[model samples]
Target: MDSPATLEHYKAGMLLSGAGDSTGFKRELNYSGPDIHEAKKQLGGLKNITVKLPDWSVSDDTDLHLATAEALATGKKGEELLQEVALHYVEGMKDMTGREPGGSTIMGASMLKPGTEGGYRIPYNPESGGCGAAMRTMFIGLSPATLEHYKAGMLLSGAGDAIGFKWEFNYSGPDIHEAVKQLGGLKNITVKLPDWSVSDDTVLHLATAEALATGKKGEELLQEVAFRYVEGMKDMTGREPGGSTIMGASMLKPGTEGGYRIPYNPRSGGCGAAMRTMCIGLRYPRPEQLSSLVAVAVETGRMTHPHPTGFLGGLASALFTAYAVQRRPITEWGLGLVKEACPAAKEFVKTAGYAVEETERDWGYFTEKWEWYLELRGLSSGTGPVVWPDPYGPAERDKAYESFSWSGWGGSSGHDAPMIALDALLGAGSNWEELMNRVAFHGGDSDSTAVIACCCWGLLYGTEGVPPGNYSNLEYRDRLENSAEELYKLSH
Candidate 1:
């Protein structure tokens, strides 16, 4: 802990270096000499002041810190304050150097700049772990609040990696298209696309990141951010967005029913909600944060998937992911958490346009079916099975497979995909390689399912748990690495 006197000295040194000056520090070493001399005079001839140094042009780091202080003094907090500070940092840097700051500062600041569409910032630079952010975080020091913010940032980064990497393969609906082909034909073949692209999933995740960066929270923030994502996607792609995003966008449009009051279909329970809720879990990883976590998860899910099953699946995924990130024995507690999240899910569905009783009845039926499938595979909510069961051996396996409307059992239903992922993980036991292969071969929603499974596995086993080959060929691998490293730093 730095003493107040030492902190004051440091502040004086920064001030003497022309930290906030837009024009004073332009002359490099010569400019610093005059500033330091003036500082000494102002300090009543303090001879020991270090500001007497000849070279002292403060970089954007100083400007960012000063801007952050100003934002804080003005009652700005969270991502919103960060955005304002970034804007001020950029302006100050440009005024001093006639250009934007270099390195990761520029990269991060550019994304927050006004007029920059959220779509363009997808696949954030993986190589942005420079000292820019760390250097300006002196004010955070050693505090629980600082750790909380760092953890939130790391979680956002991880979500970006998980969603963005999955998007690399699933963009343009290739996985779903291939699953459809296999189902239509008798071929047991799976297709892996060569090129990588992004979709509404990645766009929505980035939008949430932007919202978080600007200190937005709860339902209102998510709704506003989600609408921006829809509009940005429409502008960039010049086509109507697909998947649950279509419904989400509909809810935001002002019309006969009034904006934000539009009805969301109760049956459209796609995996979009589950895929994007991991960040929320990471941001709120404590047992105490569970209520707020569930609330935000439900709000985010209702944006696209108003169904109880839809949002419940997302909530379960987030809670499980958070537990995994905390290195809790997910295999031991995952099922129980799912059960606990169910009541909240049922309550949220009551607010939907569909008949509350019927929706609850349907939800109960679906969950029963899901639990039955788990029991048929010897994966009931009890002791862990020692051996991985063969999916092709039993009559129950066949029945479960047949129950799905698709070849890979890769139904677009949110609950179904998460169940599949959980089953695969529990079944694989300690065999990570086999788990990866099985997930890859699953013909339905392979990429999305794989993303969920991989993220969980990564959380449990860390980076070393993930095979090199899995991400070595993937785009933006560095960014994923950077995110993982930051998370590790924050957690420790």
Candidate 2:
């Protein structure tokens, strides 16, 4: 049997690999097979060729190989190891000027992040057939295997909540921007204690998050969530919660008969349900669990919202987060959720024994609203490709917000909250400032949209680009991060 590679053998292998890479780079770029043979004959032999720096430096393959080796040498394993490798890969970019790095490798490195259940893996790219990964993975084969995972969004979500809450009472539209300008922009607006506190949006979102982190399932989980909601209401004294939320929490009572629930509320089509349901996605984030996510989100949503508008908003928030965990494209998340979740939401409502006629009417309204909004982006029927770029400028976003407005508030209704959040997320891409500008510094229900948008953004990108001070002193940061970690653990 072949013996394992020793230290000396590994060193020799690495040198040999670098030398081979350098040789291949020169040969491929300079000559074809017969031409190279003629050159070899002219030079007396192939061994006569001298491969050295300046004339023949190693390519990106060898650079990445050394990066992988350096990361492994740090002795980090699993998720941390992956992150370290990604870090090294990014750091290695400075040396890649003449190396001609592969496009896929560059893209993967640029996009890679730490502390997710998805690990260091990038989304599937069908056209990424190259030897970049193979060349760099040699050191990975030499290292001992291990696993670890973790999230940073819960803290950032709270940061968004607190920051948005500051503008909730007296600011909207142009006034919100004026306030931000007065405060020297979002970057200078630090998120700290009493000055910047979370509203009821975060209180109830925490309630839902805490319940999900308990690792319970089925009816018992629902019961736990209901209990937390009731308890959460008691803490909303200065938090300025919504009327529907207060009413719903007051009505929630524990019993052995099919968990806590309330009848449909025609007037409760507000963002109350949507703001706090993203945690459901963290708990049941698998693609196969989409139905369960719908059922749970619908049930929890009805505990307060009851109407199709309210419950469906909750479903959208949760489903988007689930899609984020799966690394699905943001363009697909909105329409994708509507198509996959609407039927399940309807089935859940019917199974719970709602009036058939009323149910049909509500479902129709909910489905029609989503269709209208999705169509605005040319995602007609929830199955078409996205044909419009989401708006980023204040005027454009304001126009979009006006289109989503209902009951005089831009994102006041449950449906529009998710709509606005999704639009903001779609436009923001990896830009954190853009996300805050579009979602938080908005006209209506700023905190509601902020909570959902920030959570989904956190899941997809973590807090990589965010300023640390913005989230460092956030209230309830420990709780938020703990819940995020628990959910991340459970997700993996």
Candidate 3:
């Protein structure tokens, strides 16, 4: 190789320390309503702790977090959110080079390898799909790299897959363009992703609509645009739905691909699509401009879920991030107000009293073949499939391993890494317990996650957030930082 390929990642801790000003830190708000009340009741009345929105403001121009936080704080729409994200990127992350790997077999089985080392350097895996990028690269639409360029990056993400985890939070332009075509390009197009892959039809469609609505052209200030395309499709094709989420976005589609899958249940709540929603508001103008964005997001989602549970969930996240950027506390009013705006999240609001009754619950819970009560008593994870070091074991580094499993797909590295790697790209806090921990838990994919997470957190917090350059190499980190700034400019 021409000088040992470089590694990549996001830096969570650093952003916390640097960026913007220290005065930006705000206080936590009073926990209102039954949700906090329930948590307090469950925790034996220990309610309200010092929970301030994470310190630091994204770049000034169009801080996604700030814009999103403002929109949510003041009430806004999904289209506005879209406008905010795309508009900022005209310059924000123009140089960003990691998240969109252009060519490879995706993260799983789809990737191929050249067999020229002594014989075959490694065995070929053909199972995983690059769904992680959809989540980790939460800022892609506004991160420069056009739809066409992003796909090329995605294919290359898993480029080094043959040796170890090679995927990073890079964009794949051409491939993304193709995926868009398959997933229905902007305007009145109809398409879909490969059998196992997901085309960003929903992402692009809404973004496109926002652009068309606002008459924002050339992608200079996309967030300021509208969602006419998304709105247009609402009547005919239906709103964009989450890919195999809780409601069953996978219920049915133009093809038989969705029908064949099992119940459309995503194993996560770890901010998968929520992050995407946040980016929209993040890019929107001010809080007053959020209504359309919020409406579009919720309306688009309703095609598959009339219930609005997820619609509100997405709103909560997007607006919460928006509110967060303003240094506002995550108030009961804030949480309550979200549902008021959309009134959909209330569906999951558990009004009934709750109890935690479990016998000798331990490890291997998810793998257990026990009955209802037994399994409930012992589950690898409850209500969600979490990804992390054994939370129930001797290595009790709970803080060390942030939960990256947003979609309930975790356990072994070999079978479940690509997705994990995606999470690592956006995850905050410490690194893997050890190198072995990184690879052992998720193997090749694990390090990629850790590395990528470092960069994102780094942007949010700064360089100090990282654990040395253990995961990130020189070339990659530089590329990420420059890109992050460019994206920050685009957002501004």
lDDT digits (tens) for residues 290-386 of candidate 3: 5544654443333232222323334543444334333232222132232343332222222211110110121122112112211322322222232
Task: For model 1, give the 10-residue run with minimal summed lDDT.
Answer: 185-194
**Could you tell me the lDDT of residue 446 within candidate 2?**
86
> For residue 25, what is the lDDT in candidate 2?
79
**Per-candidate RMSD, Å:** 18.0, 11.7, 23.4
Number of clashing residue pairs, candidate 2:
1
Name the regions of candidate 3 deviating beyond 4 angstroms: 1-272, 303-307, 330-459, 467-492
Report how far residue 287 has shifted in candidate 2, in Å. Answer: 0.2
lDDT of every predicted structure (CA atoms): 0.51, 0.80, 0.29
In what order do the candidates fall by lDDT, top score first? 2, 1, 3
Clashes of each: 6, 1, 131
Q: Residue 330 error for model 3, in Å?
A: 5.5
Measure candidate 3: CA RMSD.
Answer: 23.4
Q: Write the per-residue lDDT of candidate 1 for residues 373-399, one digit (tens) a residue.
A: 556555466455523445442233323
Q: In candidate 3, residue 137 scores what lDDT?
A: 33
